[model samples]
Each structure stands twice: as C-alpha cells, then as structure tokens.
Target: MGSRTQDTEECYSYHNQNQNVDYGRMAEILVRRAGSTDEFTRLTSITWINEFVKLGGEQLVPYYADILGAVLPCISDEEEKIRVVARETNEELRAIKADPAEGFDIGAILSIAKRELNSEHEATRIEALHWFFTLLDRYCAEFLAYLNDIFDPLLNALSDPSDAVSFL
Candidate 1:
C-alpha cells in the first residue's frame, strides 16, 4: 500500500516530464475509479483528477465534457474532502474553453447532468443545476435540443425540500 502511494506520488512528480502519457485514458480510468463504492477510493480518484487538470491544463480540453460528467456526482459526495476537490476540479474544467468543433459529446454530459439533478443528495442536484448553467452559457445552440428534457427535472427541483437545490 505504501509502495503504491510512493509510486503515485513519483508519477505525479514527473507529470510534466511524461509527455507521452495518454492522459485521455488516464482521465477515463480515474473517472471510472471516481465512482467506486469505497469513499477512500473515490476521494483518491478525484484527487488524482484534480492533479491531472493542473498538469495537463489546455491539453485536456478534449476530455472536459466527459470529465465533467464524472465529477458532477462527486459534488455531493458524503465525504467533504471529496466534495471540495471535485468542485475545484469542476471549476478548472469549466474555465477551459474548448471548441464545439472539437467533437465534445455535450449530449453525454447533459444526460449525466440531468440524471444528477434527480439525485437524492441536495448537493448533487445543485451541482447539476450548475452544469445546466455552464452548458447553456457555453453551448446554447447545442443545448437547445435538450431544453425539453430538462423542464420536468427543473420543475421537480423547484420543489426540492432544500432551498439551495430549488433556488439554484
């Protein structure tokens, strides 16, 4: 276990030096790991994702939509540290400007965000709303087709017991 931790640290220490790394695959693996049932596993995955965003920066724009899909649920994780790190990662991904022509699967992200809006966790719902806002802000044209699908969930969220979820 300690060796694994040392190896992870060593790998991240040389993140910039390792230009040949297939970050897209790494992001996909980490995103899948982020969904683990174990809290420790989930937190570790998100932390590595945060580090990846920092190391890869604009180079990671192609994966932003998919990465956001994975991180959205972590916004409401039961673990506070996981929630914090996920939010930070989400923010970094959101700040990056990727061209729609780059073939981003906005539809996939919207599907994930819409599903997250229905999560029992209030934080998840709030984060989902934030996703809607961000998507609309950046891709209004692509988002238009999905407008119909969102109304029902948005209305349901309006009555959510949590004011934060409803108001946001």
Candidate 2:
C-alpha cells in the first residue's frame, strides 16, 4: 500500500535466482530421478516434470503417467519443497491431459489423489485436497461420480484443526 512497503515486498520476492539446471535435457534424466531412492533427486525431478510435459506438447501423458505416479509419493516426502513441487507438477500433468489428443485413464489418476487425500501424513492430505479442489473446479462432472467415495476424506479434512486446511 505504501511505497516503502511495496519495495520491502519486492525485496522478499526472490531468495535465489542463480538456478542453471538444463531442465530441457533434464527430461531424459527425470524418469530415473523420479524413481530414485535419493530424496533430493526425486524432489528435483518435479521441475523436470514440467519441462518434459511442456516439451512433449499434447498427447504425451500416457508415456509419463507411470513416472509421475512414482513421484506422487514425494508429496508425502519429509522435505517441504519436494511436496510443493510434486503438487505443482501434478497440476501441470493434469493440464497437459486436460484435452488430450490421446486417451488417458482418469480413474487411475484420481485413485492416487484419493489415497493422498487419506495419507497418514498431514501435509500429504492437505496437498491432495489442494489438487482435489482444483480438479473438481475444472472438471466437476467427472469427479462427481466419486462423491460417495470421497465423502470420508472430505469429512476428515474438514475436521482437521489446521486452519489452512479447514479454510479450504
């Protein structure tokens, strides 16, 4: 609102910008990283997911869904950044498949989201809710079929004491 306040917000807008990973080429390496035992690599693979999806253009999902599923558990990873990017990448893949030129199974994708919604880890459940809400917003009719199945998770999420999760 004030000039000084605006400048302060801009200053905090970035903490690091020296990243130089060749994300384009990183696509080839990402499949392995997505399935890696090492946390960092699996986490870092999320960024590559976006790059690969973008580079693959339309109808590229069937090839990548398996790899993306492998990275899905990273949403429950201990490291916070990994959880964030795993969710972001999931959104990107969903978008890529939104109007796919090739058929992709919606049920398979939704199954993972359901499991994540009920994850023992709080953050994972929260992350799944974030995606579930977005997907419902974008494709409500498709997801409506699962309303019966999703009721328990939604009720559990509603009772969560975390203000952020409940506010959703």
Candidate 3:
C-alpha cells in the first residue's frame, strides 16, 4: 500500500515536468534496446520512454519517433503515456510527409477515436477531434466514404447550447 501511493505520486513528480537532459538520454537507451526479447524491456520502451517524452520537452520528443517495430503499443496502447507519444510522433512525421501510424496498431484506433469524439465534455471533444483529423488526414482514401458515419454524432452538436460545443 505504501509503495502504491509512492508509485502514483512518483508517476508525475515535479522534477520530471521538463526536457531534462538526463531523462532524454535514458529514453534513447530504452528506445534502442526495446526488443521483443522480454516483457520488461518492451514495457520500458512502450511506457517509460513515452512518459519521459511527455514529461520532458521537444528535445526528448524526437527519440520516440525513431523507435521502430511497434506491435500496437501506440494505437491501442494499454498505457496512456505510450499513446500520447505515439500521437506526438505521428504529428511530427505528418509535418515531414510521413504516414503517422507507421505500420503500428491501426486497427483498434478508429473505434476509440469515434467513442472519444462524441464525449460530452468540450475538452474531450477537442482532443478526440485532433485524433480523428489525424486519422482522416493520414488515410484520406480509406476514410473518405465513411466520413458521415464517423461524424454522425457531431451533427446534432451543431445546435449544442454551449458556444464551444456548437462551434466545434
């Protein structure tokens, strides 16, 4: 119980809230040695490294993009931290004319994106829309015919009482 509390608090300790040089090098090491050889290493690569980048800044963020051979740790990633880095990496690549998913967990992303897109909260809606747009933009050909279906719930949102919701 004591360790659990410490772990939870340590997860986002203040010291980790920036792009610290020490953490960046550690993230690089984790990303490089990330292999299917064992669960611990894989989890380090998927979870801790991404957490480092999320807590760190732009400098550390770049290494996450180089980690190759993700077996779905991004799209349907079990850890939120992993998913965040994956999304960030996608955006970076999109800037460079690269496909975001990069052969990762493309299958499960759509359902989660759709569910989040209809969230009642405006902030939730905004974040979800970002993901949805990335998906649509990355795979324009595949998502074209299904835009209406994907965007159906948002249609009624056109008349939402809140300016933010309605405008979105």
Candidate 4:
C-alpha cells in the first residue's frame, strides 16, 4: 500500500489536471451525496469534502459558492457526525485565502444563502444566517453592494417561527 503522503499526492495530482471541471464536478457530487437519505453516504461525502477543501487550495476559489451551497445545509444535518464534519469543512473553506482575482463568486454565494434563509429547516436557516455573518466579516465592502437584495430576507427572517433563527 502507498504511504499516506503518496496517496495524498496522487489524489492532489489527479485533481489538479483541470480545476474548473474537477472541482466543480466534485462539488456537485458532494452536494448530491450530502443530500442522500442514507446517513453513511452523507457522512462520507462530508468527510471527503473537508479533505478536498484542504487539498484544493486557491484552485477552489471559482467553485467556492458551489461548495458552500453544498455543505451549508449539512451543518444542521440530523446526524451529529455529519453535522460535525460539515462544520469542520466549512471552517477549512473559510480559512482558505481566496483572492478575488481568482474568481471568487460572492454573488452566487449570497444568492444561495438568501434562498437558504427561507428554508423550512430551522438549522438550515440558522446556518444561512451564520453565512451572512461570515461574509460581512470577510467581504464587508462587497457584501454592502448587495445589502438591498438581502434586506428583505433578513427582515422576514427576523420574524421566523424558530427563535433560534431570529435570535441568531
């Protein structure tokens, strides 16, 4: 069997061939698997996504929105293990030094978060709010440009049935 380092190198090399297709396709796959009815499948996909984020580096910037959209809902997954891995993956993604020049699509991410804020799932809505907080913290100027677009959702969510969603 290959050493862990060798295995990781192989995975990295395999992924680096074409950033656009590889990362985008992988994010799409993870999104589908994360939404699986089977708990094990969801957990496995979340774990892989966490590793993928760690290994993909700046090449992932273009697909950041896709990855975030895929994993954000998992943060509130019914399975505790899935939730934990999903949160870790999100942290890893946030830590990535995404250069805006590398094509980070904040608009797409904002759109996803906005849609998520109206979700039926309480946890999903809560996570979406947390996403806005993170965005405001990191991309304050860019986020302000979309303030009007987001204002209505934030206003509506202020009256959410779940106190947890509104309070956060």
Q: What lDDT tens digits, residue by residue, belong to model 1 across residues 103-145?
A: 5667777888888887888877887888789889999998888
* Residue lDDT tens for model 3, 100-149: 34433333445555565555555445544565567577777766656666
Candidate 4: tens digits of C-alpha lDDT, residues 1-168: 243345345445656664443655566666666677878777877887777787776767887887788788888788899899888888787777566667987788899899889788897888888878888888899989999999999999899999998888
Q: Name the candidate, 1 or 2, with the larger TM-score value.
A: 1
Candidate 1 wrong stretches, greater than 4 Å: 1-16
**Residue-by-residue lDDT tens digits, candidate 2, 1-168:** 253344323323321221433332344456656666666566656655655566554435555445455556776777788777777766676565354235554555566667766666766666667667766777678778778877787888788777767677
Clashes of each: 0, 0, 0, 0
Candidate 2: clashing residue pairs, number: 0
- List TM-scores for all candidates, in order: 0.84, 0.62, 0.41, 0.79
Off by over 4 Å in 2: 1-35, 63-68, 79-87
Weakest ten-residue segment in model 4 by summed lDDT: 1-10
lDDT scores in order: 0.80, 0.60, 0.49, 0.78
TM-score of predicted model 2? 0.62
- Rank all candidate structures by their lDDT, best first, as comma-separated numbers: 1, 4, 2, 3
Off by over 4 Å in 3: 2-102, 145-149
Scored by Cα lDDT, where does model 2 land?
Answer: 0.60
Of candidates 3 and 2, the better by TM-score: 2
